[model samples]
Target chain A: MNLERLGRTAPAVPLLVLGLVCLIFPLLVLLHISLQVRGGYGLGNFIDVFSSGVDRAALGNSLQFALWQAGLCVVLGTPIALALVRLKGRARGVVMSFINVASSFGGPGLAFAFMLLIGTTGVLTTIWSQLFGQAEFPSLGSMIGLNAIMLYVHLPLYLMLSLPSYALLRNEWREAARMSGAGFWRFWRQVGLPTLAPFALGNGLQIFMWSMGAYAIPYVVTTSPASIDLISIEIGRDLESSVFGVERAATLSVILMLLAIAMMWIYRTLQRRGERIL
Target chain B: MSAQTVAPLASTGTTTSNDEADSFLGRWGALILLIGFLGIPLLALLVFSVATAWSGTVLPSGYTAEHWIGALTSSDVLSAVGRSLFLAVAVCVINWILVIPAAYVSVVVEPRIRPWFQALAVVPFALPWIVIAAGMQLTVKEIAPGLFGTVGLLVLTLSGVTFPYLYWAVENSLITNNAKQLSEAARMSGASLPRTLLQVIVPAIRTGVMSGSLLTAASVFGEFPITMTLIGGGYETLPLWTLRMFSGRVPGAGAELAAVSFATFALLFAVSLLITRIDTATKPADPVRPPARIS
Candidate 1:
């Protein structure tokens, strides 16, 4: 097979170098810039990130938003996933295609869709106003509002991500439970939920990381500072503020990167556990 | 409700009349929930795009095709679409050049380092786009100021961000198809290494390559934050154009926004169709369950 010749001829070294330069070097630069203060390297910028009340609030808001978004996505997506697995023929194909399309609805396209449906002067908002004989509907403001919008974007994604795991559920297990006189609820509560917990948790954490790092949707939806403030927006704001804000932006980015790393680590662990169970 | 008490009666039939009713109700209920939640907004967007005016109404007050025509015909919009298409295609090509060799070598020649190489490839997914853009912006400004605000820097940034999709696709294809055996076979038949890779390995994984490129292109087309932050006003992408419509940069641009939204959806739909086609065509005769840990 000429394995040695293949090894000698492969561009392994160049590929490795390209990967490092493309993926790792920018992160290293980010870290380096994050440490810089007053034209010299120091932890002062990170200290500023930790000490500032505004920065702390932004971080808190981001975590809260991500938690709620991930929670809602799981709550709403799991049942749909279960039902989807039960579907057959044309219905399954149509629903699956819809999910695929919806999962791709992120960033600006999704924000625009929601705006058309629920924003001020939005279609649904207008419909609600007419139904109640009111002039205007209440604005979708605050962290809860942001969470709702995020759920719309992320639910299908979670559903698609979790579908494969649900497919792993054996029908024989259900039959066995039913034969043993276990009711449907008991069968699911005792066996189904426990078996699928890792996949659900893993998908939930992935959603958490997704919303945590997301910038575009929040950027488009939340126009006022009085609304929810996320860390992604805060970083963008800082970076655009002034030359000095670059360091502060870097500091916040480093923090955001750390949080993402922590969440991803947990997600990977849960995914591994889920795989082992399967 | 008390299944234990009714166990003897229920044991005679798994699907009793009551159970059939429940299943029917449950299925319809789920369908309604799915459609109402995900389908309605998209439907609204489509309606709005074609409507002449949607202000102060539950539905658009009037219908018109002007916005669709405007979005399709406008020079700025057309240019933005072109730019996005060009950038997406360029990113796909760059990623292909970068990832194909890396994936091929890792899979066929250096199996031991596959894990480490995969970890490196996935780094972009972990880091937030804003953070990467901020850092890349700073780095480019400092090092290659000439390339700043040019398509050249954007090509670089997009390549980094979108590389993982193609890499994973190619790697998965290589592993699942057992490309090494084919490469080895080709080598045994007196084919050189390059010949083996180009003629044997690449063809074997063509589906993966096509799907990966399409996925990469879709992501790049929709990307906004990096384009907005790093190369703002340098080159307007389609997403940026949509953003401008929403921001009221152009007066009475609601119809245009709707058109762009629909267009984006169409693009997304087409990509999904292609992906589905590739998936169905390449599906193994004997299905291989994907390892859970791979994702």
Candidate 2:
């Protein structure tokens, strides 16, 4: 397959163009515009990220929302991952398929499905009002409902990512802990959590990244111009509806890309540590 | 939900007569949770879609099939569905032309450039769609402002956004199946480059590429942010259309939304089933990394 000997160019040219358009060129645009602040090329755009109240709040809110979602997924998904590890054969298949279907619901579609359960005058709201006579049910489009949707869509992913760590937890360790007169609480507290902590942290960090970058759900749910609370929504607003314009959005995108890279590095380090401990 | 509570109870099971029940609960807790999560919402959506009117009640006033019929027959639903289908198919076809050759060149024609292509392939995993969309919009708008909102641009951009899936999938297949060796073998007998790729290496990795394309189609089918950002105007896809009806506070939109959800979910379920069936029979153990993050 020596194309050079055959007097032909490698078909890498189109690949290069695709790369330029998709990654290289776009990043260049972001870099170029991010430098085009009101006065000229300086840290003005970067400063605005912190000095401007709305921009600062968007960054902070993205952090808060991502942290809460990732933290909850780890807490709620660990047992499911453990149970998945214990179950075997056809039963495992059935359960895994259920997880698969749920995971496939992904972002916006899952948000739509959950709307019936949590929207204003949603079925669950109606049922809750009838049962408790409260006559009020906060909709899923709110901050509370955002958490619920993130958890629902992400918990299954957590289970999948964490299952391998469960496999690292050998049954013989449990047997040894039991033979030493340790109760399950003592075993898990002293042995299990310590062993699985790094992987859980790693998995949680990945979810945090996903949640922080999430735009479609927040976009679909919010009817307003732009967000003062979320990075993705604010980026969108800057591009579409806000007077802040595409330059501001470009700056935010650059910042987000750097943050994502930093988070990924930390996750890789934690995953390495987890594997080593195992 | 803590390991403390669930574990201690299971510990007591080893010495107690209620061991059977405790162990059953311990082993099946996830299944029970999933049933509650996946099952309840689906049933609720189904009932609500078919229900005549369900405001402020645990149950609908009455059940009917009119909404489902309406959704299937409605021009809006049909057009949206048709548009999404066209986009997904267009994405699949475009990636086949773009990715397969690039993968072939990297794996067989020239191995030295593999690193660059590999690096670019993994970019989307860390890159947010909005970030990419912004950059892409700037790039496309700068290049050809008229093409900014066209379906052609969407097909290209989506092919970029979901590029990693097809790239990695086919790349893995080529590497594993030893396409370099196979291509060299074909060339030794005087086969042309096209002939070798079309006859030898392509057949070997056809299943891998096809399934990758199907999975790509699945992603495009549900894609929102890029489509919304790039072509939010002069277009109507299922996600956009459904969002419009819901967000506009369009009266009587519930039953209609449910009908669309039910239909969309059913189609999605079949595609997933097909993907799983193909993957199990063909795909090797996946790389240690998880699949693409939820889009």
Candidate 3:
């Protein structure tokens, strides 16, 4: 029986090994490069990354981008998610599929969609300047512009993560809260909010993960990356540009991965607490 | 997800009349607002793809098929499309062969390690595209310099990034079809593990596998970053070409770019239909969301 069980599992080993070589080992190589310094391995690269003005600025911008994205999605997505939960059968089906498809779209298609809608001489731009007599449409190359495009991807991603939690919200709970003389906001504050708080945080972390890790939209959107540098941009520059070694890119990548791991750790803590409350 | 998970967000009968109005608006309002927010851009792209000129108007001033013809017939566009298609198809096929057995083993044979399989899929997701690209350059390319800046590398790297989607899709299908019990039955009837999986489990889960493959294909179809950073000067996938067009490299080809964008969307929409059809038709017990215990 043990031999038979081993035979069944054998097919998976090659795939797993391929996954490691293709995905994990390369990452491990980056981690190794990230630690290497002049004449030996140490924290010298990390120190250089921390102290350099440009590197520091890029990391700061990435963190701000991530935090703002998380906050915006949670704030905007809650009402939207709640609204979605209330839809009748047919409408729910339509919107669910729309959200799912929206998440898959990134890179150039999304960039062009944004450009066609909001870029200078774009449809909305052309229309708005005409209607409102405002010639200055929002720039797609600015930090705000970049993040807005980031939301194009991150918002749908957050919805996909958080929408499932709304199923836990029931009409009965609200009805009970009202019967206990609690008003709407009060009920949510006392009960509804608590029930959903962990998930909201979980969803926020998920948004933070994608938002922080995001590269494609930002890469395409920003015209002057120098003024609005993201860590991924820096990493890309170092990887491709001869002025900077691959070490810098590897170091920054490690830092970015660490930030994501930090979020995962926090999520793990929240899940433990959440399991009890839930 | 199950239908009941969408049990309406009802206003209690006791709540004020104002509450009903709020929810009524909120429900339909959300759907319409999202549709308009997301959909108008799509609509505009469609119109622009055929437009002759619309410098400062609410809509296109004129329409023609010239841009569509030019964009579709361009040698650059054709090569990029070929590369993109090859990458998409290859990634989907590679992941298909790899994920099925791995998912079966982790989710069925040894259920305790299911989360590990899931975590593997998600970790790559949380890495920035540049990091993945850099890792590929530093390791994979160095190992085989021949593969550098090739669509072949994109195929291998993308399978790394996208297998998670297929994993979740197929795993959900497997669970929904009760693969463990079905496999046990097949085994008792003298079928080997490979035979049981190939004959019984796969046929049952093909819907998931098909949609999942198509989903990954659509993702690869529009993929940027890795393709651009690694292979930009040496190669030109559809995305790099599109970006070049958008950046005004091609000069007065807005209509062509719009046509290309619209064409891309049409393919994505077509694939989406298959994915959502399964979601709505079979009503999988879980939607496409990532499972719990991770961000």
Candidate 4:
């Protein structure tokens, strides 16, 4: 009877349908597969994932990797973001463009680049060996090295995300602090760090989730599946090995999803607090 | 007069010195960190690409263009590049087609139910890629075994994986640009809903659509695990091909790895440059007002 109501309903219905078919349906399918272990419906796969030593190790490795990656990103990215917001003109533009490129510079391409730069017989490694009289440079394939690569990929992202908080730190507040006889360190302690704490925490959690879910970089850098036992890598290995196969992979996927959702919830809460502080 | 100005002049001098020191630390210190952390590895990749032999030395012993020539001329490399490009373009087109209308409907037509739709859209980002891949694989196997290991399935998986990028970008653009007002104005002039959307809303948010498309393209170009696990049977995208090269399958193909990295860098650089150019060109013309809540 009403043209306006009809017009609105027409577009809304199709969008709702598409979202259901594409997004909601697949995730439901994933849940279904996770439930269907050994041609039956049960929580056996999840129990197996938690009870097994190797699977539990993979989960632990992923958590540790995520925590270290987030910590390192915050340590390295904050000063860079603070410095960036203080800049003006062409310099700011150039540095920002570089950060943009770096933030988007992950995936297999970045893995290859790092491999060429620091792998065994790599340029930097070769130089270190020759100069120091060592046979080989420290391997970039270890947990430490993997964390370093993850840091390089994630630092720019954290910096970019945290720039708004830095920008919100008005120069007037610093001037007022100085006028009140506060020194640099005191001002930073009293004003700067407190204001940025929520933002830093939020950014750290975002980076944590990102590193937890990363698949390509670790896949390319490590020589073997067991070399790095991240959940993502474990999922891939399970799918490939045919020992645990799709059901185990699906079970692991559900676990990863639950962890991510939990982390995302924390991140959102911190972000809201940060916004309120600003 | 000189004696009177001395007091203020001394204050100004001290302030200038302090300002200079601060600028130095901010500029040069930040630059050095960025170069050390981000730039040096890329520079090394470039050098390695041209090296005649770089083993056990800081620098390449000699340089040649042979690797570049061979990498470019190889049919396998070319086909891999072609497939990646084709996939990226197809993904971009599909995303735009799907996202534009959906963003429009949610943001303008039925803002009441936007959150429900938005939540669904963001599910891909919230869930791990492995889960999505595993789900799609099992579902596809059951539904259409014929489509398994086909490029078409890969495209579908990618569209689902990468749809959130475009959806959020376009949705933000629509909201910020006040698309609903423009649509209402068009409709008041006797234009139908579809006509108003096509002419008014689409033109208003063209830059956002382009940005989202380019970002989606860049992302799909670098995608590895999905392409490898799902479609590695018959399809080899650039990233997968690069992986094969690094696995020591191709003899003397170290330079090819370097070349692929550079090419990926080049593509990412171009996409970023275009995004910046669009941002700058559009920024001054449209001073953003805080958008009114739609519903």
Candidate 5:
């Protein structure tokens, strides 16, 4: 395989043009919507999105929820992924498949099922009452309930992303640590923790983007007017509620895209630093 | 779930006996974590699907097939399943076409451009499917107005989302195996590049290609946002159909949801098993990493 041969095969112009167009179109549309005003061109929409307290709150809440959910997912998912890649035998296969399937699980239907489980008189609450001898159902409607479900929804992806790196840790390293008389805490801190950090950060950032941008999980699980109103939900609500201001939704879409891009850049930089350390 | 929670001892102690115990703990630790984390939720889902009244209890009061029966009869479930299957197959075919040529260049044609092509393939992988859904919707609105709500739209959207998986699988196959040896073996016998690619390289990576396709199918089949936002009211895939079933009315809706989940899981599980077989078969028998030299 050679570069000269690749150049000779075709001009490469068409491919380059197509790639650039595909990459740029969505961002351009977002910018266009963000800058446009009532009847003409201006920065009013952008100003409105940023200046308005509600819009700012929604953006803040979205980030907060995304961070919490993604964090929880990474914490929970890493061990499961570790088990899948490192463990063996019949039982392992069954567990692996179950996690794989559950990772793909959820839709609006899942959101609704969770709603039933965690909501008032839901299965979980009912069980809680029976255990505690409570007369009435309790509320689980704060950020914790919403974020927990969101974490569960995104756990599989985080796990999948983190599994390879976790698997990359050879068994010999563990054996070496044991032979050296390193205790559980020492082995984890000196060998395991350092190895997994970069992976966790890279995977965490991706999970953060997912949790932040996801519309369905939050839409289904949370309080109306969404106590932790994220940007995606706002965009959807605007699209559904507004008569002709589809542009507003478009404007928010731009903001989200920019945030995602920025977050990814930061994530990659962190990964690069991690690579250097290793 | 297993009560076993033995942990591997860190490699510090001198005794062979201790090392043996550590090995046992490592294996058992993995097993316990697998059951506790993954097994429990899945078991919960299965138990709930069968229980006539799962509410108000840690365990289901009783078991029944009413949910399975309800799912079978439900028009929503049937149509959703049908649509999901169709979309997944369509995505598999479309991605396979784009990937074969791209992978060909990566492996057989030009090696220097390989890194760039591989990077381009993975670029989309880094982006969430939701971004693609949003981008696809916007791109469709501007490019081809009529294609927006059709099956063609769904197919194309899923293809873009899944292209990387297919590319990585096919490319990894090319890089890992004795491609140059096979191609040189063919070339010395007077086969053209295209012939060598189609006959030798294609067959060589067939396992990788199929595994990639299966992975793509599982992802696209389970995908929800693309169906919701892009396909809109016209197309009703399994996820969308399940969503409709739960969102709307009909008796025993919970049971139907459970049934669809089971069906979806079974279908994906079968696909994954086939992939696992192909992957293990394609790899070299020796456990060591293959030589780095690409053809």
Candidate 6:
């Protein structure tokens, strides 16, 4: 029972050491790469990420994209989550499965799938053309199309994050409110909306953090002049580009990691508050 | 209580009736919204997969088995599926091996360190995929040269990136399981820590392990960036094969694409059902007992 006594003889120490070593390798290697320069220590790469106009633009665009995607995910995802809790029977299972399966459908897969739906020769576009007599169908590469696809891609995660809170509401309570001459809006105002607030906030933070690191979805969806640059894309480019040093790529990566950490801290804080409120 | 007050009672009935109608409408409205959100995209994928020629039309010209046939017959496509499946299973195994022990230590050994360990394990979630891919590639190429461009690399990278899915499941089970009781009981009966773990703790959390494995499998199966960067060219997974087929409009490309999507979709659905079943099976076991004292 007292494993701590065996801690001296236990193999757990060695195993823990190995696990820690494995975990730190990637982070340390990347940091080492970031600090390495042309045979000496230098802050050149970090400077480039901050000072360069193009790098600045890419970072700005990525943040903007992340913001839009996060906002859209909440708008589209919350209603479906609400529906799942309120709706009953076999229908709920199917809907929940759809949300889960489709949520696992990544950016590239969904992008191409949507291309078949909304491309120039796509079914929806052709219909729009026939109805409106517009010869040219809009590209699926448009910002609206990209964001819409990403929103759907993220639906499952937000739904899961919100479901527990939604489940806290008792059906008997709703029925009682109805019996007492209370209507749906009256019940919702007094009960449902208030309970859902913390869930919405916590889930919204997760969605935001997820969208900020998003690369694959945007990469596969768009090829417009407006789309060629983002921090992730730039890092990939710099990694491959002989002209740019690896340190610059590393610096950009570090910046991305910091941004992600900040977002996660915000998310964790909100989650803690939600847990407390519950 | 006069005739004027009685006048308000008549309006109350009208408003109540309207409220009933509005509530009915809202419920249906909510249902329709959810249906569209989940259904439209899925239906789109299904239709696209079967479409013979979907050119500039609201619908495809016709449906065919051509793509499905092509996908099944192609050796390359078949191989990609095989590779993906193998890697996913490996990812599942590796994740469970590390996650179970790490989680056990966190849960049974020292509850004080549990939160810190959990936070560290899930750090992968917030980290960028591209960064992970890059780090994985460098690590594999330098530290484990033979692993680069192989299924092993995929298993390792994916396990690291997705282990949190398993850790979450295992931790939830451990906390709710009163693992202390089970292990204590086993130890009292002369079971060693490892045996107690293998026989008692592991079985108790089997559902969690299954769910986590399913989740990690699904993730590894669909993963692209890590597979692409770390494995490099030549050894393409299903997604990479699809990507190549996409870039180069090969003869069987459409069918290959459809096949891959449908296969992945089917796999995901199956895994999700499996997880749902596990959760439901475990549901009754829980709420039967309260949380154990933190001793």
Q: Which runs of model 4 end up more than 4 angstroms from their true locations?
A: A1-7, A12-15, A37-41, B1-27, B284-295
Instruction: State the displacement of the C-alpha of residue A109, model 5, in Å, after optimal TM-score superposition.
Output: 4.3
DockQ, structure candidate 5: 0.29
TM-score of chain A of each: 0.88, 0.87, 0.91, 0.91, 0.83, 0.82
- Comparing only chain A of model 4 with the true chain A, what is the TM-score? 0.91
Task: Give the winner by lDDT: 2 or 6.
Answer: 2
User: Sort by TM-score, best first: what order?
Assistant: 1, 3, 4, 2, 6, 5
User: Arrange candidates by DockQ, highest first: which order?
Assistant: 1, 3, 2, 4, 6, 5
- Model 3 DockQ vs. reference: 0.47
Residue-level lDDT tens digits of model 4 in A159-238: 77787667889887766665555655666788989999998898888778778877777876766643667888877777
True contacts kept of each: 0.43, 0.39, 0.46, 0.40, 0.14, 0.28
For model 3, residues B77-147, the per-residue Cα lDDT tens digits are 99989988888889888998889988888777877557767767767665666677788888865588887
State the lDDT of candidate 2 residue by residue for A1-278, as single tens digits.
46563345446567667776777678788888777866768878888777988788878888988899898988878877887888776566565555655664654456666776766667787777777876654455566767777676678777877876778898778766765666666778999999999989988988888788887777766554432358898888776764876778888998888888898899989988888877
Question: What are the per-residue Cα lDDT tens digits for candidate 1 across B39-61?
Answer: 77778778988887786577667
What docking class should model 6 receive?
A: acceptable
lDDT string, candidate 5, B48-108, tens digits: 6777877666677788988877778877677777888888898888766667766666566
Best by TM-score: 1
Weakest 10 consecutive residues of candidate 1 chain B by summed lDDT:
B286-295
lDDT of candidate model 1 versus the reference: 0.75
Can you give the TM-score per candidate against the true fold? 0.92, 0.88, 0.91, 0.90, 0.83, 0.86
Q: For each candidate, what is the lDDT?
A: 0.75, 0.75, 0.75, 0.74, 0.64, 0.67
Per-residue lDDT for B166-281 in model 4, tens only? 77778878987988888888988999877887888889988888777777887787777778778873788888887787777778877878877776777677677777677665
lDDT of 2 at A40: 69
Off by over 4 Å in 2: A1-9, A90-98, A104-109, A164-192, A224-228, B1-24, B108-110, B292-295
Per-residue C-alpha lDDT of model 1 across residues A1-278, encoded as one tens digit per residue: 47775566367666566567666776778788889878688999888887988888888988888899788878777877888888886556666666677665665666667777777778777788778765543344478667766776678778878887888888878666766767767777898898899989988887787788777778777776567778888888776665555777778888878877887788889878877877
Model 5 chain B poorest ten-residue lDDT run: B286-295
